[model samples]
Target: MSDTPTEKPSNRPSPVIVLVAPQMGENIGMVARAMANFGLSELRLVAPRDGWPNDKATAAASRATHVVEAAAVFDDLRAAIADLNFVFATTARERDGFKPVRGPVEAARTLRAQAAGGYRAGILFGREKFGLDNDEISLADEIVTFPVDPAYASLNVAQAVLLMAYEWRKAGLERETDIPFTGPQTVAAPKEELHGLFGHLEAALDTRGYFRPLAKKAKMVDKVRAVLTRPGFTMGEIKVLRGIVSSLDYFSPKEPRGAGYPLRKAEVDKQAHPARRAEDAGEGSDD
Candidate 1:
């Protein structure tokens, strides 16, 4: 890796976030806050509850004044999004199955890809109490929903805006996680390493007569291997698992499972030279 930091990906004009018939000024302000966090600036309001130039909104914006100041108020939903090339309506529940539905991540990526071709897009968020009526959502080109618990699927107006905005910024970046700080990347263990781990674990289990019914041993081993490998463990995880297996295979304490096993040499060393642990943490606390 290079010692120098790379510049962030160049961004085109972001999607316009339109809030339809928003009830609370604070929620509108927070929507601006969420938008500014992810590099979005355009904000459109349709028949806001308490009227425009809301002082409550400006106070709640938390210094995201630019988005709030430039916000455009509209008489209705149709006129608000008339100029946009594409539009998305956010909903919590599954509606009548006419329009295509998308999740937040896919919707954001689609918006970003379209922006690159000089096309514009907008995301519509309904009010806090009652979301977009069927008539309002019908105006959007597509529907987007959050995969939240069905029992409590409703989201705060600002919270819904935050999710869409976060996904939009993530779509612009190259990293899968799109986080600020990161440790050394570890990839999935190679097949050779995985096979060795399976063999070692099976041998340990075999020695302990773990397969009660001998006829079922092979099927049981297959199941165990399949379950362990399904998660695609990284190389570091493979090492840790092998260490655990080696410990269990070799070390036999006089006490039964009630008493814990002895600490390893590394743990003893850390206890003896406590400062080493602090120095290790000073290397940036990877955990």
Candidate 2:
């Protein structure tokens, strides 16, 4: 391995994630992980439950030690976002007072613009069980609400942080690249090759009396063709399927059928339901 140590990017401007009266240590660590995923680094906690410098939080953070280590603790919301120029409070429910509400994407764009003007921006998240109270929300410049189900709008603290972080990163992107296909590169088989394979398989099945009941033979054949044509098989795939059909045709045991063999209904029913034959024979003997 190379001797170079992994370096974190410091070029982009990221918003400060403020957790107000957060309850669990695990949630703090998970929030750190989510922040790390979308390139957000700064973390501020206001009155976290179970105390600070928690081992559970550290463990749950996994590889996001940088976020957990640099986390700043504050006594209240105002102290946590004292230096920020703009603050957004996330809430699921509507409050009594009128406040400008923005979705995650809009909030991200606004934060980006504010940061470009050399001003620090932060987002406030509430407690897990009860979200931000009316008093705490009044401190924010704008309200941010997720467009989720009205009946069940509550989101986990870490999940809310992740969604906002993802939007922030996405809004900053110039363009996105198409997903690369990793499997073997093969072109679709020619029409002639596909037709030959279909004919070969159908011929083998016909010899085994698979297309029964002359009236339904056309429909059954069409269904079989539909299944085979759905995948748009490649030349290599078609060859493999042809080989499998050839092997089955050669190795399968075939009973000799006399010339001009009549199609019997009883034989067809017995083949369809083998167990019913015994019951039918017993009933016939009883009669």
Candidate 3:
């Protein structure tokens, strides 16, 4: 394998990474590099201490000049997030708040759902010295705290940003590439297939009265869709899911149903998916 880096990523519906009151210009560059590494290009700077047009940050960004050059400088956090429909604040310190707290993975999933719903979202990263203040954190609708040791919870601004960026990319890759091995007939379920899956499952659930209370049905469906779309399900996996849903909704196992639901494509058995079987055996190793 070549040692060169790549991926001049295209524009996508990704969360805007907002750095709030960053202190060091070099750290800002490093954060930008981290974002670039993870295919995130939208960068927002809010009242950096050294001010805008920092040469040090741009120099530190290495090849991520595009992200640095396109970065938007905002006077304040409110103005920075004014156009965003949802926001997540990253902080290590525990504080009193009614907002929901989640890990990076869950936050990434929520961000993806928000993007799918055509809503802009952003994540706030605080100053390198002391994380986001109580007031700043309060501005965010949700909190994303890293699962670090409680005794030493603090992380460098770049490190914190890198963690979130990695999770965000991982949530999307879903075994598409960047792996040592891949399963046979590994086809990433395209956005259309995912949307189709959502429509199918939602319709099935509706017939079973799964959505309770008419007023909250939309919100409930949104949450369910988020969970379903969280996994990078393959095309085969999507077919299996649709087939399972069809069987449950239409066929009666106890009664005299002639046959179970048939998938559009022929089903592959255990022998056809050795990679998945390997993954199943290796579950919890990373945890």
Candidate 4:
């Protein structure tokens, strides 16, 4: 098989991110970073409080300089989205009119569909503190609300833009096929090998008296088996863990009384006076 993977180009045009009366330079930069993260470009600023070409914004954007440098500034909301055929206004509060409302997912889907059909689209983000006024929201084609806690529904301007942009990118994928992995490939361990590991661990723990209160031994063993089995450990992982257990067993310092005595003391210390042990240890340590 060829080592080089094929590149697929998207047919849909990315939605423009428009900020209405944004107050902070840092926030705009963060918005640019979020846009870059999800592959969306084209930034439009409407009457920014700190003005355009802000140094703070450029500094905060870090590697997303293209989005920051190419950002366009406009005088008002209407002028900001004038060239776009479809626009979505993000809001946390309810509006007075019967304007159609959509969540980020639905809005992204519609935006993608519209963009594919050769229509320009954009999403409007309001100010940080009070958000967009009624008139500003009314100018957009639809209102977008996040499914958030009603008691505290506010989201930062950059964060709101990130959510919408992320959804828009996610809507275009037919399947998730770009996940990365490292190390040599191996199949999961066979059931017999897993059973052997369980038995080996149980035998070692039995010698160490790990299952306390004799009556609860069976239940504890079951719980231990359940945890070990859930991960579906591969043969490589199983061998590594077995080797670790063996090395631990070989190198472990011996207690004078018994293996279980130190464990019992630790449990008692944890339940009774947690800080007492730490203080005792600190007194003897050179550091």
Better of 2 and 3 by TM-score: 2
Which numbered prediction scores highest in lDDT against the true structure?
1
Between candidates 2 and 4, the lDDT winner: 2
Candidate 3 residue-wise lDDT, 1-287, digit = tens: 22333332434589999999999999999999999988899999999999888999999999998899999999989999999999999999878868899999999889878877889999999988888988989899999999999999989999998999987886765342454344455557898998999999888777666676768999999999889877889988999999999988787554233333332332344347777666667854666
Global fold similarity of model 1 (TM-score)? 0.62
- Cα RMSD of all models vs. native, in order, equals 15.7, 6.4, 22.0, 9.9
Estimated TM-score for each candidate: 0.62, 0.77, 0.59, 0.74
Kindly report which residue stretches of model 4 are placed more than 4 angstroms away from their true locations once superposed: 1-8, 176-186, 198-228, 244-287
CA displacement after TM-score superposition, residue 242 of candidate 2 (Å)? 1.6
Predicted structure 2: lDDT: 0.86
Show where candidate 2 strays beyond 4 Å: 1-10, 115-118, 174-186, 254-287
lDDT of 3 at 35: 96
Clashing pairs in 4: none
Candidate 1 clashing pairs, residues 3+ apart or interchain: none
| Residue-level lDDT tens digits of model 1 in 48-104 | 999999988998999898999999999999999999999999999789989999999
lDDT score, residue 102, model 3?
Answer: 98
Residues 1-287 of candidate 2: C-alpha lDDT, one tens digit per residue: 22322223336468999999989999999999999987899999999988898898999999998999999999988898889999999999988758899999899889888877878999999999999999999999999999999888989999999999988876665422212234556688999999999899888878777777768988998999999999989998999999999997888664542212444888878878867887777854656
Find the number of clashing residue pairs for candidate 1. Answer: 0
